[model samples]
Target: MIRAADPSDAVAIARIYNQAITDGSYATCDLKPVSAESRIDWLKQHQPPYPVFVWENQLGEVIGYSALSPFSIRPSYRSIAEVAIYVDQAQRRGIVGGRLLIHLMKTAKKLGFRALVALILEKNQSSFEAAIGLGFQRVAYLPEVAKMKQQWEGVIWVQKDLTASSQ
Candidate 1:
């Protein structure tokens, strides 16, 4: 089941996210795992207007999560949102990420968002393809945008229109 994340699920979310960070699929450098308290504080600090959702398995575990944050602080950019999706390493290739992203897009549209964007590491082809499969277009490629482990990596910015008229 896919639903809004709760404070209690922070621990599970942090565990999954930490796995990604450690595996180098998420962050290129090693980082300490985030605590449940921090996750709960984040949930409390940003709710509704900015949404965070989770996908739970039959066992009621958080297997994946997705979120939409303001694209820019300017008032005119209110209709635009930047999105991020993450799934448990064990849950990858099981469609969890796809499902969570679709939910995020639907929710974003319902929230009156005009555009949804995802910034992906150029080397992460799976993520790039997934975004395209979900209707996002490759809008830009930022060369050597970030350096990780002494290697420079590019960033691909993908976008999808969420307006009814866009369909």
Candidate 2:
């Protein structure tokens, strides 16, 4: 089942997120792992309007997670939010990330977001495919914007216009 993430879910969430970070996943470009305590702080930053959600197993273990975060710190950008989803490496075949993205899209619309954007690694075709499958369109590409593994990598920004769905 999927539900809103709380401070207590930090440990499991951190473990899953760290794995993606270590594996150079498309969610982020970070190369270091962070502690649960830090994750708690991050969770705290996302309050009611933009909350984080997690998928749990029957045993109550967090296996995947997603969130809708403010796309920009400026007040004028409140209608746009960023999407984030991470699934445990051991649970990839479960399609957890796809489920999480679907959840985030609904949540974004419910929270009055006009659009949801995902900044994905250009080289990660699977992620791009997943986002497109979930209704996001690749709107822009920034080439050689970040360096990782001694090579310049790019980011593709995918966005879903929420208003289009209601009309």
Give the candidate number with the greatest lDDT. Answer: 2
- Which 10 residues in a row give candidate 2 its minimum summed lDDT? 23-32
Indicate which candidate wins on TM-score. 2
Candidates in order: C-alpha RMSD to true structure: 1.8, 1.3
Q: What 10-residue stretch in candidate 1 is worst by lDDT?
A: 26-35
User: Candidate 2, residues 55-164: lDDT per residue as tens digits?
Assistant: 99999999999988888989999999999888998888667889888888888888889999989988888889999987899999999997888889999999999998
Instruction: Score residue 19 of candidate 1 by CA lDDT.
Output: 82
Per-residue C-alpha lDDT of model 1 across residues 75-162, encoded as one tens digit per residue: 9998999998889898898889999988998888889899999888888888999999999999999999787767888989999998
lDDT of each: 0.84, 0.89
How does model 2 score by TM-score?
0.95
TM-score of 1: 0.92
Clashing pairs in 2: none
